[model samples]
Target chain A: MLGTWSDGPTKSAIVDFVGRVTTEGPNYVVPEERVAVFDNDGTLWCEKPIYIQLDFIVRRLAEKAAADGSLADQQPYKAAVAGDLQWFGGAITKHYQGNDTDLKVLAGGIMSLHASMTVDDHAALVGKFYAEANHPTLGRPYLNCTYTPMVELLRYLETNGFTCYIVSGGGRDFMRPVTSQIYGIPPERVVGTAQNLKFEGADGHGELLIQPALDVFDDGPEKPVRIWSRIGRRPILSAGNSNGDDEMLHYSGKPGAAAMRLVVLHDDGEREFDYTAGAERILDHADQFGWTVVSMKNDWTTVFGD
Target chain B: MLGTWSDGPTKSAIVDFVGRVTTEGPNYVVPEERVAVFDNDGTLWCEKPIYIQLDFIVRRLAEKAAADGSLADQQPYKAAVAGDLQWFGGAITKHYQGNDTDLKVLAGGIMSLHASMTVDDHAALVGKFYAEANHPTLGRPYLNCTYTPMVELLRYLETNGFTCYIVSGGGRDFMRPVTSQIYGIPPERVVGTAQNLKFEGADGHGELLIQPALDVFDDGPEKPVRIWSRIGRRPILSAGNSNGDDEMLHYSGKPGAAAMRLVVLHDDGEREFDYTAGAERILDHADQFGWTVVSMKNDWTTVFGD
Candidate 1:
């Protein structure tokens, strides 16, 4: 069912689990209760060099910097204008290394971009980018960079009576427009970090303005909270590829009820860039908890869906 | 398709809208875009005496008061212990009158009740209430009180390739368990006021605690904000029964795209309720906007689905 997956233990484990759960037996989970959540960037699609969302943001920031000299002097805008990929990726790395100072500045800079725009305007901007922009290094469409094995895994789960959801730390509004076509998941099924939405116009004909702040950051410990809030049911299966997914992976598995957790290891440097910068903690836990760790180098026959 | 709806303009209008939108023509909307949102309280069920969730809350408050002497002296707790339904309903009335003084007190009392438990425990309490509690004034089970016409309307829309969601001011977690069985809308499709959820446990084995604070109040103008955040698309069809639904109804209908908004008027004293306490503003705008006003006396042949 997972066509891009090389015949291996990772594939066999997932297939066996689905068989037991869907069968009318002790492990049977009703369709309504069969919830599965997957992290977006590194797991479903490539987040190498930097996140796809970050690339989109930096490009937009650079354009604004070219027009406004004052904005060009700002830290993120300056980095964006110069195309300093290290600055953006380094902010994330610094956050993981117990320093959130750079990350806070980076997050604030991102939120400021949405402050002046309505959700519709922001979504249109993102939609235009998705339609026109290609991956900088990969030289392909942004949608083409999504992992083929992971997409196949999602379809296989759906075919076996599981509703798959995209739970990421990326902007929810940013991902909703393309999630359905790209991942076969509806907009309502995609839960992520939310922007502050303000209701304008009194009694009728109101618009939701995106404020310069995040209402919720769906990462680390917050992932479990967002999952419970949005789904209202514990997921039967969860898959991710970073330290931020540790809580979600642990939350999905229980002692009695059969559950599965999968973590993708980005180890195929030839086909795809390989680095464990953000996934060190998660990989360790996967080993200790006996969670299925899919090695990209050995387990996937192809990388991108195309 | 809408068996419970009487043969009238209200029924005909809804049917025609669905037919035009579902068929292949200029007004046709793809199944993915056929999003429908419904207000849960008065629109979907009997909210005449009190909101179903509010009634559930009063019962729990009364139970808490019986055990603790200190809590019994409080305003809402005292009122709950005395079985004072007027106090509970009046707080909502005060809110509509633009004086949120009592509503603030009433909301704080409710939030305090949830602060002590995890989501699983709070859900169990709500589930038990749905299973065992009866509507006080109606003298029937809580599930038995949901409007037959609305339930039929939900099914009819779903049958015609529309996805229906419950967007209410009531607690999102409180309504989730019964929404699936009572209204044919699953837990994930239910969007309402959210209680803040906190994740406990570090790297693995996490539990989400229901914090004693509201993350979002999905009512009034905020209804449209919540709708956009969750659905990410303006609904083609929306329904509600009170002033809280004004923005949502207006938001659904644009200049051209073809949308329908249904507002239920509780003017049938015999079968259900006859009142205009909280619906004065919405009813006034309903006439102005040409939004279809469904009179319970004339539009429905039955009340409860059973």
Candidate 2:
């Protein structure tokens, strides 16, 4: 599965580790709890400059603002409608601080705008956005920005009976609609940030509807903690690309029976957009912790799904 | 595991279905997509006059009310504090809705409740809660109220490579904490209703803390809808007790596969709580649609953990 690591350091280490854990080895074993976790955004797919979900939300907010005209001048949203990326960045943090009248009002606006469509409709919207929307620096479809080595690693873990789960800071509802076809991981297994939803009955006939409210952000160290809280089992293997995934890697590396953690470092720019400029904090920790930091340029023969 | 199904119509039908699904006979095989799901409360456990989690929440609420001097004149809190079982039924639905506010407040109040404690400390809390709290009707530890026949059915499905998951309307986080110990099912395999939780940095370090919030109720049809949205993989076997699990059973019996949906009718008031007083809506579809309805009184040698 590790095509780049077929004869190199990255491939050999993983191969050796797998061999020792299986029945043929000296300490041969198959622990009933063989769980693996992955960070979705940058680790699995393209998450640089902006997350895929954030891009979707921004586009959604702008579309709503354009059509309604009522929220036309609502700070960041107004900037979003005017196609101003700088103002959009400044307004997002303010919006998250409960700055709006009701978080649900803002969330419901997005949910209602998007919820009427089926999964296929939503997928088409996302697919269209990805094809046309360039990654500021990568200058390509967001889907084309995925790390090939990490995808190979995901498949490798699955071959070993490890139940891999995506624990991201992205929206659970948003990802649930598309993750299965894209990642080969089903919608149910994708755990991420989620907004609170309400189910209201229509005329007592028990019809279901989605109501949105600001709920939780599953990011940073929260990744691993939420992993344990939601999944109960600690992952024996973990992979991540940013500070958001640091805790997950640490959690996987905690002194245990069979644990391994790999941190993906974006050092390749020719094949994929490299993040050597802004993600210094993440790069520093990867070196400090003695964890394997995978160099994109040196590690893979491809990027994205071919 | 239809141990007591010697001659009764309910028992014979259950046995016949299990035989068909597992054996190599003419009626043996089932389509892969004919998935099954089971509800935990009342269907598997004794959620009579009150649900198990509600019992914990109410007791905690009364303790807080008593401490704050609010229970001195309040009807539900005072009755709860005084351990009046008869008054509990009148307050069940009211307590279910209003309890969320108190639960959110209480959950928000517990700053480092879990972080400070060791694993043993947490297990002790569960043990203490189980020991001190008595079911309103059963007069035994709430854990002891679990139905044994259902447990056997769960084991039987696992042996047949029919992947099973606990799809309930209870809090996913709360049920996850002890489900592995009690049900032999890990947290990832258990799906349930949940209060929204935000993750925060723990102890100013890289560690994280999960905090609860006010949110949606995942009962009735929402149970199955969430199951399909979250797990993606549907079950070929399904079971439940109340109207909450009706959709899940419906999902199982769809035309795609030779599926079986079973409903457990709690008919033994002496051994278990009876549903005759109309505690929950028992649908007519179970019989009309050819589902195996197991009468609790005639199906098992025991009711709870032996």
Candidate 3:
């Protein structure tokens, strides 16, 4: 049972949807077809003050600046560390806004930061960051900030034969370390933006080196594209909370399939931050699209686990 | 328990490896980490005459040429259809051999064949091809030619809580349809080469269109890189039968991990084929690398299922 979910219409909808898909009848989906996908960031955990991956990137940039001092003068690096919203939004959004040159530059900088290290080394570094990094407002480790109801929902779905996946905009490698422990999802089930990796060494003796380049951006409409290419199945259920997740949710609820789409609305200021942020359009279109909107204030008995 | 495996060192090795990894002991792996990867073409099914995907492409090319006679004069198309070893090997191997321009051209041709189709449409096309296509030498549908012993191995691993994956060099979409039925491996567990896909249509309503572009070519060294990026975990066991699988096997047997690597040697001329082809170097280096070599003639009591 979803113990963290409050007694409300949102919880009832989820329960009914799962029941319809799992019970024996014409509507019952076979176990193999019961695939459920969840968007990370705000959908699985808090992304309020700032996206946690961005927080990790900012910290890494600061470390680079500390070591070299020359990096501090870089345009994006200086603006990013100072938390300049104008320049940060311009530079960062340019990549997401379909600027090829800007994406190349940003990808180059991010990849170059850890490209020299093998994947194992990079994972170890990310593990260290997750252990030390704390949510700015919550003052707790970022790992502890995952939504309790969503975590319970993932387990409930899995218990009913659903293969749950975290299809996030965050880097795939960055999310793999914590997803298994927190969401009970394995590394292979976590799909996201990726970097090209190189296989180096002789025959029967080789290592995969993470290269300084971008592979797939896995955002916006790219979410559905990736879900199709990587997972090769239409997910019967999907959950998200931002404009980036809009297309993915739409793709899940495509015509002819008995799919359920849920959007988490971050409207509980006392328990969590209250802001529509980039999710304004998604919230507005929920009723039109027949998507269930889960209001944190009304639908969740608990926000974050202790 | 292994009805199709002959009494041999290879069979014993496989049984011992599974036992060590499954039972509670110093070498025991947790159920969550019990990942096993297999190469699809020769290891799981037949690939002697040619790769089944290449067969599909050639047929599609012929259909296009019939509609518009211009394609018959094209260099790659002409050479591919006539089974011209020189141009066919050069053009096709360029993608595997890492020639960017040739890969782009080949990818363009392959992607163009199905670019307009949605993911579901393309999958349906592939299904129709499988229903009609027959193995050149075996006189049976390619799907039915899957190795009985290997199929048994997959089920055995699954019964023991091991997650099996088909890490093939064939197109990911091409392999997804039959993998579940033939090998009991699901689509998400099938990682292979991919093409860029596009999300088409209006907001809250769209389909993923397969595009004419190369995403990742899962061959040679790319195998390990993809395994790491996609699976995010090192497989405890890996099986393959060609040089393309060299890097993947090596990555699976990385230091400190209790890993087992098996190479299927297609030396049973009566039951299957006889030559090593691209697997020569792998067969030669198996001893030095501690990889088990499975001889179809000696290790498998039965090759194909009834």
Best lDDT goes to which candidate? 1
Off by over 4 Å in 3: A79-108, B79-108
Displacement of residue A123 (Cα, Å) in model 3 is 1.4
Chain A fold similarity by TM-score, each prediction: 0.97, 0.80, 0.93
TM-score of chain B of each: 0.97, 0.77, 0.93
Among these predicted structures, which one has the highest TM-score? 1
> Candidate 3 lDDT (Cα, whole model)?
0.83
Q: lDDT by residue for model 1 over A135-233, one digit each (tens)?
A: 888889998998988999999998998999999988898898899889988888888998788877544455678888888888988998888877888
lDDT of 3 by residue, B178-273 (tens): 888888888988999988888875656778887887777888888888888778888889999988888888888557758889999888998889
TM-score of chain B of 2: 0.77
Using all chains and alpha carbons, the TM-scores for the candidates as numbered come to 0.97, 0.72, 0.93
Candidate-wise lDDT, in order: 0.87, 0.62, 0.83
The lDDT of model 1 is 0.87
Candidate 2 residue-pair clash tally: 11
- At residue B41, candidate 1 shows an lDDT of 87
What value does DockQ give for candidate 3? 0.66
As a whole number from 0 to 100, the lDDT of residue A83 in candidate 2 is: 69
